[model samples]
Target: MTINCLDLFAGSGGFTLGLKEAGIKTKAAIEIDRFAVETFRHNFPKVDMHHRDITSFNDKEIKSNFTGVDLIVGGPPCQGFSVAGPSQYGKLDDRNNLVLEYLRFVKVISPNMVIMENVKNFINGKLPSKDKVIDVVTNILDKLGYDIKIEVLYAPKFGVPQSRTRVFVIAIKRGCGLPFPEIHETHGPDKKNYITVGEAITDLPFISSSAGYDDSPDKLTYNEIELSTYQKMMRKDGKGIYNHISMKHTPRLIERFKHIPLGGSLLDVPLEHGQRARNGTDLDTKARFKMNNQRLDPSKISHCVTASFQSTFVHPVMNRNLTAREGARLQSFPDKFIFKGPRTLMSKSLLIRENREHEIGLSQYNQIGNSVPPLLAKAIGSAIVKSFKHKVNDTRRATHEFA
Candidate 1:
């Protein structure tokens, strides 16, 4: 039996890939950004795609492409609730409204199962108004007649090389008797079990942070052997070396990078110009890192790779921010899964985000950073499939009784 799925708010098919890994076929996907939509089409050439505001996406048209969608899965952008982000839209930003849009489709499609993902803070987080986001979500999903199970899944616990934590809400139709996915602990709580940043990207070619974008989607091997089990898994069934381009940084930035040691911080680097200060000179006048941590420890799992990692995270060894390719490896995306869109913009400032009216469009870096780690997704998918097997057995026994 084929399990059909629709990826709502599908940003370059991250959740879709997870479903595919779980033996599900993605029937269609909807994304708002022009760049994300283009990348999704490039990767999943045969899959149907809709590009535009999903609120305006008509169900009548969707019905023509697919019938009886078994699952609808997506992670509505949660920047407003993201602990790493501003965290208080105080009022619904256009992005936050996508949560309602997600529920809208769930009500329409009424899939046997629905999976929604968001930042870890989403559970207790509030929208800009009186109603809590969680309360609104649970109430609406309950009204739609689905039983819900919510969990805050940590990425590394399920084989991702990073320590990203996100909330997943799984809704199985009433009386389905399906439990939430069985959690797996692949790597955690021990030095040997954890995947380090070096282990994840060691097999890829070393590129300078100050390099320009490369258009070719050809694989470039690092001339080194794939040593880690994690590396082997990502490289498995992969043929292309795509989206490895580095940000084109300036001479001063390059000089700053050189000064930082392995796992050193951009914040700690001495500045070229500013009001002189004792700690590396003119620290206050310089660009603030605003990083959760100033440096990445090469020997350990990485900090979350946000869209702004270009300026925020220092390479464990290289004198640059992690390349898009390196970040993908850390995110457990196979080498074949190349990111498409502008590699790096002239500026990645916070201005556009502050303007509540505008959405922060995804860049290649953003696409990879914002994705669910494919390994973690695979684990979840595998568990879901396991539950479905039980569901199938239950149906068979019930049918036999009826007969």
Candidate 2:
């Protein structure tokens, strides 16, 4: 009755951790990012990790390596399908095609259940082959004899502090008589009130932008601040905090943060310190984006934590941005989940220009930002586990009647 999983495109093992929490075992994981692989390895040392491009694996190699996997779970890279990206690229962005690679693995592994997660826009996004991405994926799953269910889940409803919405495609093999699993909301107006940003992270010790270390021997212990129920849960297994280092910011940027209020963004900053035009001139436009250097409101849930969140979000009370540890907390990563690799990486253009693209990998911030919130993943995993139990019970009843 144990459920075994194969994680494809597993970024920092978020999905795997959630499945583990739900009593499912992840037998193996595949990831292309080296830093992500490092973080995954550090946390899940026992899980087999294939640190290579998923596309490079031939069908024979996949079948030979991964057999008897009861479930397959992953979040194919979503930059191309994300609405946050350039609209002109649309389906043409090469990353969008990775979904096909994900499907290829599923075909080879022949798992009983498959769960794929992506940005909410992915549900309607089109593939480069002029087909709706969802349609193409579901069509293949149908032909492969699997019933599919698609839904856009709001993270906060599942106990994550951030308002992240993602599309989940759940496929169950035909004849299981198992419908899509129903994951009930644990946090909302009707249930418990959504966890606030403060509740998620206030227990951690505060550090300034100029303070803290990437990998110090010194582990920070809990301060005297009262811990919230969520914080208590995060620290349940953690002895001390690591990877809580803050990013160094320029004095000018620090000054700008002073003018911004909680829940404010770029629009809140004065023209003198506002976002500059490409040519370094001040633009008089009042355009504002919720993601631009957003100062979180401690009383409410946070805005979406994107991969570039190190620079996108300002700390609620501090003038500097959130540390990798703080971002992890908002994503519902427990305090014990230590992130590995550089605290922050150079921009892609800068790295490419410097010819160091291969030398450097995803930063800790990038790994945390790109991860699925563990709590939300746990909800999905629990639902699937429930379905498996139901199937077992039904089989038992049938066998008893026949006897």
* Top-lDDT candidate index: 2
Top TM-score hit? 2
Model 2 scores worst on lDDT over the 10 consecutive residues at: 85-94
Give the per-residue lDDT of model 1 (tens digit) for 1-403: 6778888888888787877888888898888887788778988998888887887767785566557788888988888777656665444444676788899888878888899998888887775564678889889999998988898888877777777888999888886676666756667666477788877887777677655345564535454774788788777876656787777667766676676666555555555532234575566625545452245676888887776666667676666677877888888888778677777554435645565434346778778877777777778778778777778888899999999
What's model 1's lDDT at 127? 56
- Tens digits of per-residue lDDT, candidate 2, 1-403, equal 8999999999998999998999999999999999999999999999999999999999999998999898999999988888877434543577888999999988888788999999998877877776888999999999988998987899999889988999999999988656678887788655358999999988777777777765662656566887888999888887578888888888888998898899998888888888777898875646546468889999999889999999898888889999998899999999789899888888888889998878668999999989989999999999989988988998899999999
What is candidate 2's TM-score against the reference? 0.96
State TM-scores per candidate. Answer: 0.88, 0.96
How displaced is residue 133 in candidate 1, in Å? Answer: 0.6
TM-score attained by model 1: 0.88
Candidate 1 global lDDT = 0.75
